[model samples]
Target chain A: MTKRVFKAAFVSSLPVLMGYSAMGMAAGILLAGTVKLKFLPFWAFLSSGINISGALQFIMVNWTEALLPLTQVALLTFCLNVRYAMYGFSLIEKFRPLPWLKRGYLIWSLTDETYALEVDSAARTPAGENQLDFCLGVAFLDHLYWLIGVTAGAVIGAALPFDSRGIDFAMTALFLVVLTDQCQSKINRLSAAVGIISAICGRVFFSTSNMLIPAMVMMGAVFIIFRGKFERKPEQKEGEE
Target chain B: MSRETYFLCMTLTAGVVTIALRAFPFLMFSGNRPVPPVIRYIGKVLPPAAIAMLIVYCYCSAYQDKSFASGGFGLPELAASVLVVALQFWKRNPLLSIISGTILYMVIVQNFV
Candidate 1:
């Protein structure tokens, strides 16, 4: 049973393995190139292992180099990662019955791809097989892939003398892909527009370094003001019911 | 503080904040207490907006120094971003789209401009 769950989890995580490794390598290379640290691979391992965030991995490079204020780091991290907070809502019940350590690890490693795989696995658990075991397997493998990818990239980046110009666009492309995917929903379209507009306004009014906080504040205010429009209609709720 | 210690603190801050956010729902609603509708609404709408904002931020950083008149008139960034969005929409494969777009951007900036 354990072997079956592990196999299934491995299969499910293959795509994540590819995605995390590629993206993590990009982030790690960026870090190695940007930061003048002595132990590039060590930093890569520590950051990727602890945060396990694709976007943060990229953005943190700048933060580390600039030594941005801790308060800003905390807030920016919140803005960039608030979506993760929502992910746990759908997973609360599934993880509730887990032992504290297991559940804590699951939460710690609850990245976007891992969360999607876990939710997908929940739907298709094989008979008599433990879902938590499958989830743990997926989480462990994905985390491992991420760590290996980032560390390898750091080592390679430090050794090679290749010009990395324009490579950082990978981060931009990643955000674009995520935004493109999210824009498929009608409700999401409006929110995305609000975000784009707010970000532009923030950039215009404040410097680049100080834009995101204002953008987030504007986004929250707009959502609250237009809550009636943004919220699901009663008809849709009834249909779901 | 030294650079290493500062880096360590920053990582810890980010890690702690992220774990706290992820654990918020589990801690608050573990005992069958219903989540407030406001919280639910924010959850649903926040991701798309946050992602969009991040994309904008990315662009701002990428073009921070280059003007519209210079650096290939912002063509590389715009073209690569458009390619990424279109490929993602059509193929639904993130790895393919991101790699393709990044390569295109690198080639353009490295050789063409």
Candidate 2:
């Protein structure tokens, strides 16, 4: 039974394998070519293994090279990944009955891709198949793919003879893709406009290195001051799901 | 601090914060306490706003050192970004969109500029 579940999980995770490996290689290459760190592959492996976050993995290359203050790093990390906090709400009941170790691993590895697969697998789980085992199988395989992609990219990047100029644009492209997807909703569009205006204002008033916090502050203020406009109505929220 | 130690500290800080945030909902609302509406609203709206803010920041950083008269007058950045958004919107394939857009930007900057 366990073997069968693992096989099913592997089949479902093939798409993630491609996505993570390609994306991870981009991030790892950026880290190696941009940052001046020695033992580049080791750092790549460490950051990828620990964070397992797509955006943060890319952004951290900049943070390390610039040696940004810890407070700023923490805040930026939170702003970029705050969505993970809400992912747990849907998973709370399902994970409550799990053992401490198993639950902890699941929570730790609750990336956007992994979370989506877990939820889908649960809904479609065949009877007599253990859901927890399937979840674990998916989580472990995804984690391994990310690790391999990043480390391999670092190795290749360090050995490359050609210039890697303009590769950092991958991060910008990623952000644009995500924003385009999000803007499909009315509420998201309003919030994104506020964010763009706030960031432009921040760039005008503050240095590029110091703009993010101010932008975040302005964004939060706008969201609060106009909560009624931004918050979804109950019926609209239901429709979204 | 040495660079190695600084990197380590930063990694640890980021890792701990990430794990804590992921664990938040489970730790707080496990026992039947309803999530606050304000918190829920922020969670829903923050991702789009934050992502948009980052896109602006990327543009600012890419052109920070170059003026409008130089580096193809920011044309590469603008053109490539448009291509990315358009391809992503049309194909809905992230890898295709990013790879094609980045390659175009690279060729323009490396050869034309």
Candidate 3:
């Protein structure tokens, strides 16, 4: 059963894995191009952020060398990740079903994309073949993609003469892809719209990327408060016989 | 930092976290019980909101301290944005849209930025 489910997840995540690998490459190129980093130092930077914050790791090299404000950086990161709390809330059911060891593992791989695939899949098709397989599959492949890219970026940064401008758009491209996958849903569009408005408003007022949290908070509140307006009819019909 | 020390930190931090999160769901919920209401609720709205916000923020912030000649969108970003929208609309594949957009940006940078 485990092996068969793993195959399903692997097949499902192939597209995401491809995207992640390419984007990771772009990220690597940018990290290396825009900044100087040695291999160990690079991983250390990734680790430092991973310990407390995964999003922040991506920015560590820039934040450290760019003379960006620490407070602002932290705020933006927190706001960007504020969705994690929401994701966490949703995960209680999935985790509550698991034992301690497994629950601990699931908590580790719960990034935005992983969470989306799992929640969407589970909600769309509940029961039989754990949703965790999909989450791990997506998260695992994406991580590999990132690891490969970041490691390469560190290596290439040392040797190559790649164009820095082309690489910076990686994240932009990744987000664009994610949005495409959700064209069927209206609630998602509404949620995204709220977050965008909050981000813009926060930017205008704060004029710094660091204010992402405040914007996230504002947005998250709006989502929860108005969730009823956008609520969908319960649709999950899958159950074991 | 020393290479060995740096690698150790990342292995412990990212590596361990990766292993845990990846393994989580499969291990738990092998059998089932009634899922609480809140969990069901949160699971519903997160993805769209999260993805939408991420994309918007990435685009909006890309122009923060930078200049764009007229109103401040360097040609490449503007072009890429258009391509992103059109590709996403027409192709409906996020990966294709962004990757193509990146390629476009790379191509146009010769004349633009």
Q: Which candidate leads the pack in DockQ?
A: 2
Candidate 3 residues A27-107, lDDT tens each?
556556665445643654354334333343444444444445445444444444444544555667656666676566556
* lDDT, ranked from best to worst: 2, 1, 3
Task: Indicate which candidate wins on lDDT.
Answer: 2
lDDT of 3 at B101: 87
TM-score of the A-chain for all models: 0.90, 0.94, 0.62
In the range A105-175, model 1's lDDT, one tens digit per residue, is 99999998999989987665667899999899999999999999999988888889898888888888888
The window of 10 residues in a row where model 1 chain A has the poorest summed lDDT is: A232-241
DockQ of 2: 0.80
State TM-scores per candidate.
0.92, 0.95, 0.65
For model 1, the superposed segments whose C-alpha errors exceed 4 Å read A122-126, A234-241, B1-3, B65-70
Candidate 3 per-residue lDDT, tens place, B1-113, comes to: 54344334433534444444344334443446444554455545655565566665566555655654532356677778778878888878766787788888777765544
Report how far off residue B62 is in candidate 2 (Å): 1.6
Interface RMSD score of candidate 1:
1.4
TM-score: model 1, chain A: 0.90
lDDT of 1 at B90: 99
